[model samples]
Target: MESISPLQFLKDKSILVIGATGFLGKVFAGKILRIQPNVKKLYLVVRAADAKSAMKQILDEVYVSTS
Candidate 1:
């Protein structure tokens, strides 16, 4: 059997990620972003009080992992 990388599992797909702002989810998302920069897009599900806040949380998670 061939081993598939996590990045391969996400190629050319519109991935809908729930809990992307959470700890585990953020790490998973960060790995994808770092390895698969050409992914279609990153859809994040957040439950903050407002859309701005939710988006901020997602962005913070992803960008923080970059450093």
Candidate 2:
């Protein structure tokens, strides 16, 4: 057995995160990036007025102050 690197696993990978605008999802998504910034893509699913607003919500609420 061997230990696998989180970064290695995430590289060039696309992630679909539901409720990413919420607390837990935010933490998870943030940690993923913090641990592996080279992830190919991060797809976040949230409820908002539109695509623009959904992105805004995710940006404004999630992945902030995660250090």
Candidate 3:
């Protein structure tokens, strides 16, 4: 068995992040995007049960900082 960095795992792969609207979740999402912008796309889980809010979170936190 060997260890793999998250960036490596996410390289050219689609990532689905559950509970990614919280404090820690946001951090993980940020790291993935910051290191691997070309990792495909991110699917963030949220309690709002709608794409609008979920998209907002991704845009506000994950995408904003990187840009």
Candidate 4:
């Protein structure tokens, strides 16, 4: 018998996450990226003045702190 890791399911998959700036959403995003580094993509939908600001916020608040 062999055991399969649940993380395997996420490999090479695209994920769209809304409200990623919130507490639980941030936790979920961090965990997914940390556990499955090979995930195809992570689309974080955030509310901001513009696309640039959204990207900056995600980079600073999520990726920077988590990584």
Query: Which candidate number maximizes lDDT?
Result: 4
For candidate 3, write residues 1-67 as lDDT tens digits. 9999876787889888887767877788888877888887777777666878878877777566545
Looking at model 1, the pairs that clash are none
Summing lDDT over every window of 10 consecutive residues in candidate 3, give the lowest-scoring window. Answer: 58-67
Clashing pairs in 3: none
Which should have the higher TM-score, number 1 or number 3? Answer: 1
Tens-digit lDDT track of model 1 for 1-67: 9999877877877877788777877787777777888789778788899988877886677567754
Please give the lDDT score at residue 41 for candidate 2: 92
Query: Which of the predicted structures, 3 or 4, would earn the higher TM-score when compared with the native?
Result: 4
Location of the lowest summed lDDT over 10 successive residues in candidate 2: 58-67
Candidate 3 stretches with Cα past 4 Å from truth are: 1-6, 49-67
Ordered list by lDDT, greatest first:
4, 2, 1, 3
**TM-score against truth, every candidate:** 0.72, 0.76, 0.64, 0.82
TM-score, prediction 4? 0.82
Assess candidate 3 and give its lDDT. Answer: 0.77
Model 1, which residues run further than 4 Å from truth?
1-6
Residue-wise C-alpha lDDT for candidate 4, range 34-65, written one tens digit per residue: 89999999988899999999989898887865
Model 1 TM-score is 0.72
Q: Model 2: how large is the Cα RMSD against the reference?
A: 2.2
Q: Please identify which of the two predictions, 2 or 4, would achieve the higher lDDT against the true structure.
A: 4
Using TM-score, give the best candidate's number. Answer: 4
